[model samples]
Target: MSTACPSNPRKRDRESSPAEQWRNLARTVPATLMHIGTSSSVKAIRSTKNAKSAMKAAKRSGDLSPAGKPDASGSSWPPEAVELLQQARDDVSIGLKALRDTRDAIVVEFFDAWKVLNQNR
Candidate 1:
């Protein structure tokens, strides 16, 4: 199999140089990687909607017993512990956002380098 670029959009009507063909192929790398990274980073974060629904269902089914927490649960958990858990959850959410931002920044860096390399051409 040929290791050359897969397709040349400019080849339909006119012949294109190898360098141009390779540059076109090179342009796709950063964009594809960024999309993959974004999807992966988004998948790392979990939404509380599902948990809220489950908690509601459990409360209706008499599976949860009240202790004193009315914030998100009816379970017999100490208020201090619940507060700590909520704080941890918030931290995790912020960390996940940072992860996504970092991934996007890496992609932006790559794109910037690409632009610099192709600038004088």
Candidate 2:
């Protein structure tokens, strides 16, 4: 049985060079990781919301601390804590969108890079 060889070995070589592979990865890997991080952050936000809801349910059911204690259901958080959570959510949303945009731009760059490299052949 005979195996078929690539018709254009030089084109294949250029496409699969170590430098080209590295460049492709340099463009792709971080964007993929950032996407994963964004997914995790959104999941965490959902978990936080669920936990808050459960806490409220517990408090209403009288399973929480008595009304007079420091940790009582009636207790309130300082403005700082509330602001911090809000800021974190906002920051994550902004960062995730930015990362998505960056990924899109990188995709365009990849297309352009490949087009240029192919044209050079």
Candidate 3:
């Protein structure tokens, strides 16, 4: 068996410096936040649609047996599902608010740092 060494040394690209990485992260964080906003919007819409459909179905069935109430078992609608849906909405709201706040803070910090750097020059 013979061991062979490669003749050429590969050089890695150094385009991604720390500053560049931070810049990329700053850009990506906002995009990620936007994505989260969109996803939450979609989920909210879907949940609303599902809730409406369930209500319509119940209305159509005319099942007044009280036991026929879709939410009687607390499995799908009456209390648990409603509470869950509300919680989901609240969670998304809080998350978006937090992301927005974080993004604003990052932006302010970046600008302040930039000002300091320029002043030092």
- Every candidate's lDDT: 0.56, 0.55, 0.55
RMSD to truth, every model: 7.8, 10.4, 10.5
lDDT of 1 by residue, 1-121 (tens): 1343448655445455656655865786667667767665554543344334444554444433353334454356544445545655665666577577768767776776677557658
Supply candidate 3's per-residue lDDT for 77. Answer: 45
* Candidate 1 lDDT score at position 104: 78
Q: What TM-score does structure 1 among the candidates reach?
A: 0.40
Candidate 2, superposed: residue stretches over 4 Å from native = 1-18, 63-121
Write candidate 2's Cα lDDT for 1-121 as tens digits: 2233489655433335655656876787667656765675666566556555544544444433344332433245434444444555565566566556656666776676567557636
Error of 3 at 107 (Å): 0.3
Order of candidates by TM-score, top first?
1, 3, 2
Q: In model 2, what are the clashing residue pairs, if there are any? A: none
Order of all candidates by lDDT, from best down to worst? 1, 3, 2
Which residue segments of model 1 deviate by more than 4 Å?
1-74
lDDT of 3 by residue, 51-99 (tens): 5555555444434434665554545444544564555556556556655
